[model samples]
Structure formats: C-alpha cells, structure tokens
Target: MTSTVEVSPAARRSAELEDEITADPSRFRILTGDRPTGPLHLGHYFGTLHNRVRLQRRGVELGLVIADYQVLTDRDVADDLETHVLGLVADYLAAGIDPDEAMIFTHSAVTALNQLMLPFLSLVTVPELQRNPTVKEEIGHSRQAGVSGLMFTYPAHQAADILFCKANLVPVGADQLPHLEVTRLIARRFNDRHGPVFGEPEALLSSAPLLLGTDGTKMSKSRGNAITLGTTAEETARLIRGAKTDAHRHITYEPGTRPEVASLVLLAALCEDRDPGEVAAEVGSGGAAALKARVTEAVNGAFAPLRARRAELAADPGYLRSVLRAGNARATELAEATLAQVREVMGTRY
Candidate 1:
C-alpha cells in the first residue's frame, strides 16, 4: 500500500487517497459499481471509473457490482438492462479494468450474497437511513412520488456488496459520502454486537472534477444530457454543437460565468492535453461556432482510441460473458469467506 506520510493537500486528495484504509493493506479491497441503467458516459469516466482503472492496475483488489436489480426500484425501464450491463462491461474493459485484476459481477448472480442484506438491515436504524444523503437526494428527486421500500433499503444491499467482499476502501464522489457512512455505521454496529469481522471501508475520494452533462446539470444517463462512452464521433459532435454555453459569443474557461461553454472547453482541453484557458482563448478568438467545432474535433480525437477499443470488445459477446463468469467465481470466493465469517460470528453455523 502506498503511504501518504508526506504530500500536498491536492496531491494527497488526488493520488494518495488510500491512506485512510491502510490500517491493513493486505486486506484492503475496493468496492464500486454502476447501476447498469445506461451505457456509461463521460461523467462516469471522470467521476469514478477512471480511478478504478488506475487503482486496479496498481494491484488494488476490486469488486465491481452491476446493480441491475436497483434499476427497477425507481422505474420500469426493464428493456435495456442487459444491453446496458454488457455495454458497461465493454466500457470497463476498454478503459483497462482487466478481468483478471478485478471481480465484476451482477447483483442477481450473488444469491447467498444478497441474503446477507436481510441480517444486515437489522443492524441499521431508520433514523440512520433517513440521514443518508443518497437516500434523501433520491427522495427529493422523486418529485413527490412515494419512495419505494427498496430505495430506502438499498443501502443495506450496498452494505452487503461492500462487506461481503470485505472491502476496506470505497471510491466515491462527495455526494456518496453518506452512503459510505452508512456502510461504516453498519460495520461498526455488526462488530459491536457480533465481532470485529469486517473492516470499516474508508472513502477514497477523487480529485477529478464532477463533470456536468451537456445541459449544465450533473451528468446522468436518465437526464439525456450524458455523452455516453458508446457515443459515436458523429453523436459526440452533435452533442457538442447543441451543448449549453454562455451567450457572450466568445469562449472562456470561467466555469462560474460560462459553465456550458467552459465545460466543453475543458473537455476539449482534457482531450487535447492543453490548458482550458488556452482553449478558451482560442474559442474567444473565433466565434462560438468555431469554438464548438474546435471542441468537437478535440473530443473526437481524444476518444478515438477508446471508441475503437470498445467496439472491438463489443464484437465478442462471448468474451464479455466469460470475463463476467470468471469475475463472478472470484467474487464468490471472497463473498463466501465473508459469509463464513458472519456465520461463525453469530453462531449460525449448522
């Protein structure tokens, strides 16, 4: 495990965030995943997935859960779940999440694992659930529609995912800090009652910017503003063309003043390895029309390799399945060990 005994605040936040969970480096594991609702977009890349790739390559033990069941809790968009999962798998592979290095499995496949949620639910209180930021945010976004029991109870399920793998580090954005807190609370409670069997996974926060969608809102596939990883070059250009930008008729990198245009410029800079301010100046030199075109070109160029890699992997569905199957087996090994520990802790072993 990398030590962060000395580093600047920003560097500490960015690269050396695992100091929180180095208490037992050998037992440290990373738990993270996508809901598999839609093809992963640029938002996920910058948000969490990119970091997963980096950490996994550096020998981080990771378990990615395909929260397929969570999709139905909110809505009935059942048609594309499988496709979305496969697409996500492809995205992960394309982004360098080696199947051998990390375990990737779906929620539905882990029956014994999901069973842990029942006992785990008893370990947490309703007040704690209500205090969770993720749950509260989901309720607020429901627009007065009654929140489902699953939505309220999903945190326990998440706890199952984390503790089942004995994960000690959870990569998350600032918004997800509450969910991690709930996981830690559950771990503490379970250990207090049972034994110190699970590690309290600390939040491995990222320094990457929380990217906004094309519409200047937090990026989400459901919001229709996302630029999915599966996006074609033409689609990316079209989104850039229609992306929300400031009306100053010139480009600038002031996110406060020109969020829409500035976001596009930043994406361009990220792709081109140039300064956003420089990109902004170029856009300002030209009109928004020229700026949008430049941004589009830069983005297309940047994602070209990833686009090709994803397409190649998508061509071989059997390869994707094999990867998931192997990952499922590996995940099961870790999960069964945790389950065995749980059974022993509570004297439930028959």
Candidate 2:
C-alpha cells in the first residue's frame, strides 16, 4: 500500500515564505550545509546542493556550514572526522560552490559560533527541544538506549548555526521544517529578550526532485544505497543498472501500485526536466531494462562534469585544505562580529 506523506502546518507556512523570497532572492542571505559523515550523494544534489549552486549564481550571500561537530553527537568516536570534513569540501567545490562567492566553513572551526550555543541553550527548554520532529526521528533511527545531552540539545546548536551567520533564509526539505521552526523560535525569543539582533530565518524549501534509493527507499549512505557524488560514471551506470524495479515488464508512473519503477521514472523526469508521465509515455512498453538504461544515461550525463571536477579537486588535497582555511577565516570574522553584537545586546560585551 502507498502511504501518503502529511504536510505539516509549518511546512505550509514555509512554502508561502518561499514564494515571497522567490520574488526577491538577492535581498535575503542563505545558510545551508551538510554533516560531513560521508561523501555527499545524488540525494544531496537534488535536495540542496543544486539549489545552493543556483543561489550562488544569482548572487546570493551563501554560508555553507559543514556540521562536523554534530557528527559526534550520536557517535562515541569518529577517527576519520578530518578526512570526512575535507571530503565534504571537495564535494562542494566539485558541485560548483564557488569559494570566492560562498563562505563554506566547518562548524567546529568557528569558535565564536560554538560559544553562542551556551547563551542560546538557556533560551530554549527541554520540552521545546523534545518537540522537534527531526530529533525524534533521528533518535528513533539510532535506537540508542540513552540519548546524549548533545544529541538532545542539537537543535539549539543548529539555532546557533543559523543565527550566528545572521542568515535570513535557510534551504531545507519539508521533513526538516520542524527543525527550522525551532531555529525560528530561538531567534524570536532571543530578539524579544534582548533587542533585535538576529534575523528570523525562514525556510527556503528546495524545489529539486527527490530521488529514492536503488532499493526504492530513502537514499542514505548508512544504508549502503546511495550513489555518492564522487562515484565514477562507470560505477554510476553499474549502480543504476542494478537498481530494483517491478516485475511488470511494462513501464509506467504508477507510484501507488508500481513504486519501484515509478521512482526510476521520476529520476529520469528530473534529470531531463520533463514530466514523469510524459517520460513514462515516451518510454512506452520498453520494459524495465529500457527504463533503467534511460535513467542511467540521464544520471551519468548529468553528473559527468561533476565527477570530472571532483576528481581534479580530490587529487590536490593541499589546495582543498587551503580552500577550507580561507573559508574558516572568512567565517570566523563574520561569526565574531555577530557574537559581539549578541554579547552587547545581552550586556555581556565586557
């Protein structure tokens, strides 16, 4: 049975805000990022990375945060944290995030940003934190016997991330609206308690098409089902060819009855910027093999340049480190200014 995903009231409000921002994209500052647990995947591309690139092209002041510290919230140890962080930098550059235009920094690297967490934490209560759906979902996924204090209070840290940069806009998916809501609440409370210091950032819902995993589930690296941005064209083709599809020979976009095949159709549609029904119709009785081939070709063609760029960027680790150093320096400057304003407003500037 096909289950319907319910749209929350927050998500609806976010959609309206997104429309308002769409009219004047440049007037707003955008802050978005990923956790550097692993290399980014096609899901990252369609979900937010592509939108970041587009926003940068439009001259938006974009702040990309690699939440490296958050990666340790659920885990006891991460030996390759530095490697993952650097890998994330390579992926962003390879994905067309211009270093000169956008400020990409690691979460831990910005000292003042991390310090803001303490003051922000005081503004939010445990019950309010508990209400965050994203946290609840993550806890459920981890299924740990006990939740760490860091994990429980990570939403506040996210508030610090958004508020520290003074970001007026944040790009997120519908499922992430609750998390954004928490950030908004913290901003409102902070402004109310101690003058207006931070912009109440609104969610810029990503318009990119959502691509399911090869196994017809949500794409995730942990699940070993994601097609990473770093994957070679040959490997991409192999993975797509191995993707799950319905036993029915005929191809159609019947998401309710034939979700597996429907997903491939959706991927093809997004890759070609065409309607899923239209693509399905054009593919017409070609069966799973033909549909898979089309999806493979579209995906490979779309990512060919990205793969090439990523390879070159990956080969020069020193260059990537220098980029990160530059980003960190830029981020620290902005963060220090914001934190100073925050301290002045709270009468703690001394």
Candidate 3:
C-alpha cells in the first residue's frame, strides 16, 4: 500500500477554493506583492512571484503592491527604495508579470489606501494587536533598539493593502496565517459594525517549501545569504560555492539533520522543477562539489532569461515609470471607491 498523509483544514479549504477559482476565476480578485527594500531572490520567486504569474495567466485580477512605505516599519534600514521599486518592477516584468494585466503600484502612492488605515485601526482592539502572533514576533525584535510604531500597526496597513482593491483571495505562506487572520477579523468586525463594505478574505497557502539560506538559516539580504535575482552568473556561482554544507560524501535530502545540504538541494530542485529527493539522488555520492555545481548551474540557467529581460527593462526607465504611474492611477480609483464605501458605511462621509 502506498503511504498516505493527512491534510489540514486550511489545506483542504485552500484546495476547494482553488478548484472553485479554477472553475470561475472571473469572480475572484487576488492581491499579492513584495516589499521594494531589495532585489528579488530565488526564495521570493519560488515563494510567491511564480504563483502570481500562474494566477495571472489563468485570467485572475491581481493587485500587486510594491509596499515601499512598509520599509519604514523598522525605522533603521531604508536605502535607495525608489530605485529598488523600479528594479522590482523590472523583475516582475522579467518574471512574466504582464504590466497590462496586473495593477502593480506602491502603496505610498495611493492616498486613499493609506487613509483606510485610520478607520481600519478602529475595528480592532489594542489587546488584539498585541496578541497577533506575527506582530508579537516582530515586536520581539524591539529588544535591540526597539521597532517603530509602524511595526505595531503593520497588520492593519496590510489589511488595507488587501481590502482596498476588494481582493478576496490572498496568497500567503503558512507563517503568515496568523497575520491573515488579523485581516479576516478586521473585515468581519467592520462588516458587522457597518454595512457589508468588505468581503472576508481567505488565504491561498503556497505549496512551496520554505527555502532556507545558504547558511542553513532564514534567507536574508542583510545576512548576505540571499542570491538576489539580479546577481551576475559569476556572483551566483561564488555564493553557491560558499554555501554551508557537511562532510558526508553521499548526498541525501535530510532537511532535519542536514539542513544546509537540504537547502541547496531544494534550491536546485526549484530551479529545475524537479523533486528534491530526485535532485539529491542525482547528486548521490558526488558530495558538496557536485551539489554546488548542480545548484549553480540550475540557478544561473533559470535566471538567464529573466536577467536578459531585466536588462532590457532597465534600458527603458521611462517605461517602468509609466507602468508605476498607470498602476497607481488605477489603484487610486479602486481605493477611492472602497474608501467612499467605508465612509458611507460609517456615516462619516460628511
């Protein structure tokens, strides 16, 4: 008998939702995107960008946010964000996101979207914000030099980003479920207090496994472990070569014990769209050199097309700016409509 594993409620619900979406995608709207703090990376590509392209191809409406203002949440790490936002658009285009279809805009550019934050904050209690697992985790970071107020109200802002476009489906990772729950609560409370101004959103949990850094920890740009999308082929190989590995000669996909090796293997597998087990077996007995070579080759080959597209996009900065402006205009229209509803429902339209 083939072995079987039990699925969780969230996974089952997500499956049902995907099936419903696949059958009638026109009825659904999706809001998803990235922070423009830095370059896109392999982890980000596998994590959500590819999924956005997949949904977009299926004729789904997408409101992709380049949350530039969110970079201030930390209050300490902000650099060249406007430039980074442009680079981010280039990456999105290179990764097959059609500018004509997806409404990609910076939240800071949308006044009405940010304005919703004040009303949204009223829907939730202080204890609830403090209780949000995701926020609590981020607040834990305040022990160093302390985080900014933006850090505290980030979930509300995130809810605004999602609900502003009246997006019903949000693509999130498992770790983000708690945060999404906060958004769901806000929507529920608002709808109950006022008229039906918003739809309760649900999560589309990514099937992509968490990709750890080369050092066997969370992949981070500041940590210098992330292989950014725009890194040169030579730089990619160098980074992979420096990845943490073990002395064991026979390669195997053991994430629990051999996390470093497993991360590299997973990276290669994602690059080539193969199973991690198969990737490990293919590199069996070849050791770290073989693993590094395979990962480097796979990553470089995968990114080659995107890199060329990005370079082409970079040459036309005016086109990139126009895309942002157009998206901002469209997003502003949607946000204005939503804000009008919010004001009317609250009887604060005077």
- CA deviation > 4 Å runs, candidate 2: 1-25, 74-77, 143-145
Q: Model 2: per-residue lDDT, tens digit, 268-290?
A: 88778899999999887998889
Residue 134 local lDDT, model 2? 63
By TM-score: ranked, best first: 3, 2, 1
Better of 1 and 3 by lDDT: 3
Cα lDDT of candidate 3 equals 0.89
- Candidate 3: the clashing residue pairs are none
Clashes of each: 0, 0, 0
Q: Give the lDDT ranking, best first.
A: 3, 2, 1
- Please say which candidate is ahead in lDDT: 2 or 3: 3
Name the lDDT value of residue 78 in candidate 1. Answer: 56
Between the candidate structures 1 and 3, which one is better when assessed by TM-score? 3
Estimate every model's Cα lDDT from 0 to 1. 0.81, 0.85, 0.89
Model 3, span 1-350: residue lDDT tens:
89989998888889998998889999889998877777888888888889999999998898899988888764445667778889999989999999998899998899999999998999888888888876788778554476667878888999999999999999887778888898899999999989898888999988877788878789876677898888889999998898889889999999999889999999899889999999999999999999999999999999999888889998999999999999999999999999999999899978
Measured against the true structure, the TM-scores of the candidates, in listed sequence, are: 0.91, 0.92, 0.95
**Which ten-residue region of model 3 has the weakest summed lDDT?**
72-81
